[model samples]
Target: MTITTPNNSFNATLQDLIEYPANGINSTVLLKDNNSQYSLFCLAAGTNIDEHTSTRNAVITVIEGSGNLNLEGKDIALTPGVFIFMPANAPHAVQAKENLAFTLALSEHLPAKKGVSQKTIDIVKSTAPVIKQHGKTITTRMYEIMFDTHPEVKSQFDMAAQANGTQHAKLATAVYSYATHIDDLESLKAMVDKIAHRHVATHVLPEQYPIVGECLLKAIKDVLGDAATEEVMTAWAEAYQALAGVFINREQQIYQNAS
Candidate 1:
């Protein structure tokens, strides 16, 4: 994974940390320490890390690829934009079944809430499509609605999309897998931070979040039809808050952890 920070600020860019080569099972960085008290990582495709435990609670986010995470004997397949948390000393391992990029945040010093457990809630399961045959049509409609209604954000995405190249397609596939398991709140937080950090570097405004959120909802409704209930929207809103909270916490932590 390539790391670029604009003017050496706290913002960091990760260009396909965990990646798969053409016809080669993907693999990338598993870990790195940047002297910021938090270690980062990018795991490559088809590479597997043996079961191990860390002294620091580690948060992992899939920024661009796909993989499977084995925590305490359970397997969780991960796609782009998915987040997973392993509390300190929790035994876990990761494997890239396909090309995948991942980020990990591990801090040696962090305030603790006593009695909290590190065991993660595993949510990767196979399910039938929400709609039998109309999934793509609905998804497209929602995407169109989102871009058409929010022209400014559309411009931002359009640029990214244009420059996305092959990387963009891979990222989209990964994100599809992630949206399936968005119920994990901590994981959501990690995904949010990863996105915010990336977008902030690209000059995306904070105000665009609601617009993005609304677009996502429209997509959900369009795809799920009547299945996209009010509760679903509420859940998504809470997830967004969880994601935003991580950013706020990180900004504060940067100041407090400054040299």
Candidate 2:
């Protein structure tokens, strides 16, 4: 059975999502409308949820059995009809003494930020296949546009190396590496650090980033042509900004430390 709201979203019953003896620790979402979410959790005896925190305020309604909920380093008794209100970012955990069931309701709260968002991650991931196919061409085009349009910025280039095509090849490899590892940036820390150091040595300035970004994005549009729709271009722009943030932040620190 379904209960549809005016917005076309529907309500879900907990019983419909799970049963007693879910046999182990089990959970299912009952509703997810905008900033509100509902989840059902069932745990067997001796089962537990380790400590964690939420970025949104949450409510827990115990439906059956008994448990001890550890909240902010303190344990609280939990039984049928017991309700727990947890403020955003609170550390909590649960342990089941017997078969236990509960409903978790999360209320709207300020959207919390940690790092680059999931949307951007997906956008970058979607481009990985296309990037893999045209990475070298895109980078080579980016250099041509950059050098041709901004000849004054050519002091940073090694003309002989660019002519030999090694520079474009290196830039292409770096761009592809970043696209593949966008989700796990920590893995690229050493390489990012090396790039930052080289940029600092080469007198790369913050103001010049936009120029490179424009050329690179246009180059992508040129190389991929019809495949680089506005959405794809927008996503690549965001990805570039995210990576530029990393590079710029590090370069700032390097410049500061040197001074």
Estimate the TM-score of every prediction. 0.37, 0.55
In the range 120-230, model 1's lDDT, one tens digit per residue, is 112111212442244444445555676688566555555555443443443343345444544444555566556556665555533344455566567766676666667
What are the per-residue Cα lDDT tens digits for candidate 2 across 36-115? 66778889878888776664689999988899999999889989999999986577889999888899988754432335
- How accurate locally, in lDDT, is each candidate? 0.52, 0.79
Give the runs in model 1 whose Cα sits over 4 Å from its true position. 1-143, 158-194, 247-259
* Top-TM-score structure, candidate number: 2
In candidate 2, residue 223 scores what lDDT?
A: 90
Error of 1 at 115 (Å): 17
